[model samples]
Target: MSGFIMLKHIKHLNLQYFIKNLPQLSHIMFMEPSYSLQIYHKYSYEYKNGNSNCDDRTHKNLQNYKFKCNSNQKNKEEFNYPSISEETLLALAEYFESFEEHCDSNYDVTYSDGVLTINLPQKQGIYVINKQAPNRQIWLSSPISGPKRYDLVNGIKWVYASDGVSMHELLNKEIPTFISSKKKDIDFTILPFGGKS
Candidate 1:
């Protein structure tokens, strides 16, 4: 049978196994009838022929190789991250700028050029929060919680993908420990954190 006919009859398990064995066959079969296989084959051919000049080899699996070349590869939500990240970091910086001054003479909150540095005295430790524009992330280096890279997800929060924890959660928990000494309780609800903003 022809490759097209074989593609019609192949089961999912067999298809995966076949793709694993004949990696080039993925370029031949993993596509819709109307989709162009020429570009996919060109990449697979160049990849197999020792043309390591381009980044096609980095896709891991030769299957679905066509997506790497497609301009619309990223989903809609992913495209929104840059703007969300910018807003989130800016909100965080603004809040800390005002909050730090009243808390302690020894504590310093400095926000300059997309970096927010919180210096707490008496071994409370230094906090460095900065906007990583390229990665679309806000990096936090906290004394109590170590480090985490937060992505701006659907809820308008800077969330660490690993532990499902928001940057606000860590700050609300840890910030009070160092700053809530003046008979005043921290109101985390008022901060410009999560929700549809």
Candidate 2:
């Protein structure tokens, strides 16, 4: 069978699995048929040369795949982070500073250089929240949830990349529980800039 026919057959048989497992394959197959044919020919040659481990070969090829990115583009499409303004940074800093007053004597909360460090004696660990200016994201190193990057969405909320949990919501849920205090409602509405209130 021709490589094109074989690919069509594979798609027909397991379209969902093909899309899920080999997303790049679907892209090449649909967007660049000639490239897909080249890939097929290369793999066929490799298979005929005694490289029978298809999984290993596929993984290796994927690792070597050169994803194209335009250097002239002002904003790269791969990253979802938006541009954060200076006023927004100050507002966020102010918001984090408020946590210091609410924290118990045992817990040490400090805000400096757009970074918020929370030392929880009861938890026996530190939580670090910092603004990554280049990425326009807020990174959180949490004792409970490991590391998470949050992007500013809707010009106001810093939302987690994976779970879409807002920074205010995450802190309100986590910090109060960590310090054994009642859940405090954090106000994210008071942005310094004319951002979405």
Candidate 3:
């Protein structure tokens, strides 16, 4: 298939997957057929002796030798981690790797003359962050604004979503209810009590 065709196929598959799994996708754009065909020729012919490289004896031997060594090492480690499933351990390792990447991607917090700013990508519109710690309190505000204060943390369980809900629902209402339901110790004031005598 031409590069243009391949790109279209890839894009189509991606769109289809998103449509089926995620109900939140607003739209999916497809690559133009003309653009796909032009790129196909460029990718297919640019490689040097592609099939011959695979057939090389030295390369074949090296690949097989490396594969056997890797297989044996993996087998040995399987027994070593008998207490923990290999899949779970692998997942934990993958999670940490992605966590490190997330930390790297987050903006640096800067403070200057009573103003605190967190520089982030401009593509994100009207950025709002609600952070909370188990020890202290829930923080609500734009990270670009000022110093973060942590009083007695409001028992919250907010979720960042594209759904149209008022900030009251986003912060005050739904979160505490969710937390209260989840943990019995988390006593949530779902509805404010009357202050009347």
Candidate 4:
């Protein structure tokens, strides 16, 4: 009866909500040791099964995941990996530029050199996309999920090193949703690739 219960592995947001509502819960009989224990067990199960009531929009805000790196680097001489060609880089820049023009004015997009930045309104955060010439990768810093690195495969697609999600697919899924509104339906497909329409 003197020991304590440690809630391990609870997500940060869930923990915050629990702590915030503890006083209210206590007022409603949760202060009783047995009731508290029952509540804790119920929530613990929910957390483990990914059924927590936390809002989906804010779930990815926690930057706790580790980024994956290339494992094929075996020697210092081999460190200099092949990067995307100038032509491909130009195409990507053009693509981003087109996206900027089509997206709602609420967002501020900029592309310079090999970097493309999408600055969202306050509270939404920013996304940074750039080419890692030395690593032969395309790197993304997502406001929602933190940093991810992508490598080109088959001379056509840039794929995330950890999950194999293509850059084209990720942007197509994320960007439109971020800027969606009643009047605007942004199409990420407008991004030009190697002169293709």
- For model 3, how does the per-residue alpha-carbon lDDT over 1-197 read when each residue is reduced to its tens digit? 22112223433432223223222221111112233333323322322335322234434433343344344334333332222222222322232232222333442444333222333333231222332333122233543333232221111222122222222333334322222233333212231210110
Q: Provide the TM-score for each candidate, comma-separated.
A: 0.55, 0.47, 0.15, 0.47
Candidate 3 to truth, TM: 0.15
Ranking by TM-score: 1, 2, 4, 3
Q: What's the CA error at residue 164 for candidate 4, in Å?
A: 1.1
Error of 3 at 103 (Å): 34
lDDT of each: 0.57, 0.53, 0.28, 0.50
Better of 1 and 4 by TM-score: 1
Question: Which regions of candidate 1 fall more than 4 Å away from where they truly are?
Answer: 1-83, 183-185, 188-190
Which one wins by TM-score: 1 or 3?
1
lDDT of 4 by residue, 1-197 (tens): 01222223222335436644443333222112233444455555565577766543323322111000111122212433343444445555555555554455666767777887777644377888887876666688987778987655434555554454666677667766565354265444344332123
> Which residue runs does candidate 2 get wrong by more than 4 Å?
1-103, 121-123, 180-196
User: What's the CA error at residue 14 for candidate 4, in Å?
Assistant: 38
Between candidates 2 and 3, name the one with more favorable lDDT.
2
Compared with the true structure, the alpha-carbon lDDT of candidate 2 equals 0.53
Clashing pairs in 2: none
- For model 3, the stretches where C-alpha displacement exceeds 4 angstroms are 1-13, 24-158, 162-185, 189-197
Error of 1 at 84 (Å): 3.3
